[model samples]
Target chain A: MSAIAIGLTGVTKSYGDKVVVDRLSFTVASGECFGLLGPNGVGKSTIARMVLGMASADAGNITVLGEPVPGRARLARMRIGVVPQFDNLDLEFTVRENLLVFGRYFGMSAHQIEAVTPSLLEFARLENKTNARVAELSGGMKRRLTIARALINDPQLLVMDEPTTGLDPHARHLIWERLRSLLARGKTILLTTHFMEEAERLCDRLCVLEQGRKIAEGRPHTLIDEQIGCQVIEIYGGNPHELGALIRPYAQRIDVSGETLFCYAPDPERVRGQLRGHTGLRFLQRPPNLEDVFLRLTGREMKD
Target chain B: MWGRYAAALPANAWNWIAVWRRNYLAWRKVALASVLGNAAEPMSSLFGLGLGLGAMLGRVDGTSYIAFLAAGMVATSAMISATFETIHAAFARMHHQRTWEAVLCTQLTLGDILLGEVAWAASKAFLAGAAITIVAAILGYAAWPSILYALPAIALTGLTFASLAMVVAALSPSYDYFVFYQTLVLTPMLFLSGAVFPVTQLPDAFQQVGRFLPLAHSIDLIRPAMLGRPAGSVGLHIGVICMYAVLPFFLSAALFRRRLMR
Candidate 1:
């Protein structure tokens, strides 16, 4: 096993009476891409803040890069890079100046920052827009620049919080491709995201969070297979109660979500055969995925 | 956790230079506009009150009215520059621009950010105060050599107001929250602190209250230096301004830690 890069032991945090992060524990190994998946207000961002020492854990302990957190946080921060959820780029500065100033914040000298500017700009595909103000950059471009700024220090571990939350598919894909290259070069990453597809594509191991507690955690494929099975059959637009009664014996588990019934089973053919003669009912049989596992673990209720 | 945070404070003093440098780099693009804005108000006040009002009331304190008003302008301008920097500009960076959040993500701690903000405000105040002093010297209201004696007091005035204003910044939730400080505290301080008129001329009770105000002590030190007269109660005045500068600095830091750290 690789050495641990991040470890939390029963960490708990609260604001006033509301417990934001309950007794949660997880670890990310070196060179691993770990994802923290959750809905809004589920303590995903709170965990990220605790790791970065922005918010202190009210109970238990946290360690980053083998150093105790909130104590050795400044030292750990030297080797850790962060891409926050919002756009905190300096709006008064040009794109190049943004990178340069961030580099300065990490105690990098002018010569060092200047040496890496061209390549970092090229890496973000923003060579031509170096002089553009932050307000002028498109959302996609700004997100890319934020990622590039995080790399200015050449950190050993990168923590990205909802990196592609508001970007277009093309923009998200571009970011994912860049992250893949970083991981290929042996950089450990801790990612928090709501997009299951992004987690399935990028994360090596991920944990699902619900109301500050860990609901499920494993390799994406392993969790999906263990919790959801091999395939899902979605049957819609029919007498749902009658169809569920007929499909129950053929499937391992069934979930009803308002005019739709999701049937989970190992073999799609067997389930499909049971509904062969059921006309006027639409059904889609496909392989189960991380979304199914996530819904199963965190439930289908909408969270505020 | 609080003990650990307090321990991190002393070792991080020089780290705030990065935040100060960052602000300087951003300000470089519009340096001329900012310097002019800082200097404009004090200059107009000096000329307007010194020449316009001086012509009516001649030599109230054994010197030309312009000469007497010149020293008060130095103290008041420094106070205003530092106050505005810490209150409006610092609050904007903390809440709206999120610049402090970006810097805190680095190795720099919250203490470093607070010190850097106070230092930067003092630097801007010093520049404005020094410029007004030079203008006063050219206008024949101040002796060139005596102005040098007042530089330390001017810097102390900057730090005092900056640190005091940071307490307001830490407590403020929105831009509109600043109006209370400006109206209730700053405007009253400007009038009662002997910046526009002498505290001795006020009624007996108000005169006693002015003795405790930071601005009154600042003007006490600066006014004599500008007129080339012997300074009175120098140790008491410096002691009061230092108390204002140092105590509020720690208070503001504690408040910021509470506000920023959840």
Candidate 2:
């Protein structure tokens, strides 16, 4: 394996009495997209903050780009770019000015920033909105500009926190495409998101975190195959308990919710055959996804 | 706790210049309007109190009330400008705009941001003070070349108030919280600091209180220079201003680092 771009060992962080990040350990290899997937209040952003040295870990060590965090974080940050979850763009400046100013924060000169800004704007498809104020731009445009701003210093590691959370499908796809290009260019990425599909699409390897603990870690597909199965059979309506009992014989695992029974099996046809005579129940069988793995590990409960 | 805070402060002082430049670039967009807005208050106070009140009150000490008030206005304007910038504007950048958060993600530390903000606020206050000083000079209320000597005093006043206000900004949860500081602290400081009236005329208790207030020392240094008179205990006034400027700066930097790094 290539050298680790980011390494966290038994890292723990807490706010007062509540532990935000438990003793978690993970590594992101160089030139790969790594995802930290979890639900809200599961300490995804907190972990990202620790890596960036915005917040200190209560215990354990974090090394980014081979430098100890919180101590040499400023040196590490010079090679790392960050896109926070919210739009913290300088609304006081125009789109281009924001990039220029952000570059200066990294100690980049005006000439250096100017040389790369045009190409970056082109990459983000924001060439036309160069003179537009941040508030004047659409939600997608602001997000794109923020991404472009992050790249202004030509950072080796890109740390993004839910880059596409509030974006529309079109905007999300654009960001995803841009991220793929960055990956192709060998930029190491550390991404955090609750969106399972985003992880499945982008991450070469991922870890599922639940309430500050890492429950599972592996490639997306491998995690799904191990935690869940190759296929999921979701049977809706009509006596969930009875249906669960019927499907239990053929399925590897079974889960019961309010009106639905989810049966995970290596072979969908075997589960389908078992439910052949169940005319009163509505059933759907499809390939198990990361969502199924997430649901299985984290449970299907809403988090505020 | 002090050791941790000391560690959190920036090792390099020059790093704050970038943050100062960032603010300057943003302000450059509305340069004219911002300058005019900053100047209007002290300008109006100069005319209103210096002329209208001057007509009724006549001379203060050895100099005319307009001349005395002009010098005091220089310090008061710096205080007001710095207070508003650090309290309201810094609060917005820190919380609403999240500009400081973005800056913090880079190589700059919280200390850099704090110093940069204080520097920027002081710069704005200096401009406001200089403008009113020029107006006072044109109105014949200031001694021509001697009044220019008050620039350093005005700058120090700016730093003192900006640093003091930053402590408040670090603690403030919302915009409304500033009202308490403005009314309870700033309003009292303005009146007691001999900005609008003579400090000696105040009661012995208020006079004793004024001695500790930064603005009182600021006006004492500036009032004499603007009137072409000998400044009394110049070193003492400058030392007091320096203490206010330096101590609150470290205090506020520590406060901001604690607030931000958590």
Candidate 3:
């Protein structure tokens, strides 16, 4: 079997009365891109911190790179690189300087860092930005620079938490592309994001987290097939309650709008025949995806 | 483990130059500012106390008042600066900058990092003391060739305080605790350690109390050199200074590793 880059079983973490991760159990295999998906306030960052060995778990075991955590984690950390959610790039240094210093922290020699720095710059698509002071760079440039720093160790397992957060569209896509390149290099990736499209595009397999628990886990397409059905039709043009009432007979699951209704079934087209007598009904049918799974699990409890 | 880390470092002479070059590039302004700010306190004391108050105190230890105060102030400034360097900057690195979090993650051990920090703070303290001596030169202190002795004396003083500061740093919860150390420990030592008056002036009980602090031996070793004279107890002074050196060095390393290291 390929190396297991990360593993956790019966892992629990808490803050005062709040149990953030309750007996959390999971693992990510080497050379795979795994996603940890959750909405806001869902302890995703807390889980990421624990994986990085920056925070203590209240109970249970955590292993990375085939070794028991904390003790083995020290060795594993040197081999694994982490791109934290916030961009804490050393503002005192230039973009290249940031990478250079990070390499220094790992005790990378000057020439070795020199050799790796250029490739990292190219990977982040900020080769032209090597000389710029980190403070002078734009938000996206700084974010990419932080990712470049994480790669200086050539980590076998790359853990990135919300790596593209607060970036422009172009910057976000650039970061996504860079992440994909790392994936192609046979690097194991553990990534967390709130964006469904990102999860769909990158993760080979994923786990959905809600309220400090794993709600579901599977590949994107399989998750969509099993977690949500063929399609969801949301009708918003008419009285949603009445529309919900009218569509209830046709849908396996009918969700209401004030004036329109969603007819969810394998054959949503059969809704046309069923709705033939109804007039001025409007709706849109879209494919099932992570977002639907997310909503179906979360139940819109004020994401906060 | 260390070998694996060093294997990756720049093996060439150019690489060492670059590491220090970057340190200088990033910190030169800080160096200049620190040197001036550290020297200024002694300068103000030289004018206010050495010149102003010395007019009444007259001769001390057979040297002019300004000259006597200058050498003592040199030791005081070095200790004070070194203390602040490790306490303020190093603790900030640990807690605020999260710098140490990034540092210890690498190939470097707790020992190497502690050594580097001690060396850095000590070197900065040496510069501060050197700056005060320049002011001593303009004031016509008898010491001239004594610059050689000044080097190790100031370094000893630096090591003592730097180690003490590191211990404080390991325990410090915030900047306020450092200010407390200054008020309670550093400030008292400056006035009590014979920085101006000789230790003999204090009571027998107080003088013996002063014997335990590192600065007492520090001033004992420094005064003769700055007076441009020689005294007995070279062996005793050297031994005490070495204790000052070895004790804090080991303690700082051990404490820093225990407190900050994983």
Candidate 3 Cα outliers beyond 4 Å, as residue runs: A235-246, A254-264, A267-284, A299-304, B1-25, B104-115, B134-147, B167-177, B202-209, B228-262
* Model 2 chain A: lowest-lDDT 10 consecutive positions: A295-304
TM-score-wise, the better of 1 and 3 is 1
Ranking by DockQ: 1, 2, 3
Q: Mind giving the per-residue lDDT tens digits that candidate 3 earns over A1-304? A: 3478889899888887888888888889889999999987787888876675555577888888876655445567778787777666667788877887778766678789999988889888888988888889988888788778888998888888888888889988888898898899999999999989899999999989987888888898899888676788766666665555655666666644234455566778776666666777676788877887777676642121
TM score of chain A per candidate: 0.94, 0.94, 0.92
Better model by DockQ: candidate 1 vs candidate 3 = 1
Among all windows of ten consecutive residues in candidate 1 chain B, which has the lowest summed lDDT? B2-11
Model 2 regions lying over 4 Å from their true place:
A276-280, A299-304, B1-7
Q: After superposition, how far is residue A12 of candidate 3 from its true place, in Å?
A: 2.6
> How would you encode candidate 3's per-residue C-alpha lDDT over B1-262 as one tens digit per residue?
3322222222333223323343445667476775677788888987789888889988987778888887788888888887887887767766777655555444334445555566667777788887877667766774688756767888878877777787788777788878888889887887678897887889898888888777878877777777777856777766776777667666766565445532
Between prediction 2 and prediction 3, which has the larger TM-score? 2
Model 1: colliding residue pairs = none
The best candidate by TM-score is 2
After superposition on all CA atoms, what RMSD does each candidate show versus the true structure? 2.5, 2.5, 5.3
Instruction: Tell me the tens digit of each residue's lDDT in model 1 across B1-262.
Output: 5535752353454787887887788778888999999999989988998889999998867888888888888998999999999988888889878888887778778888888888889988999999999888887889868878899999999999999999989888887888898899888888788887777788999988888999999999998888888899999999999999999988888788888877
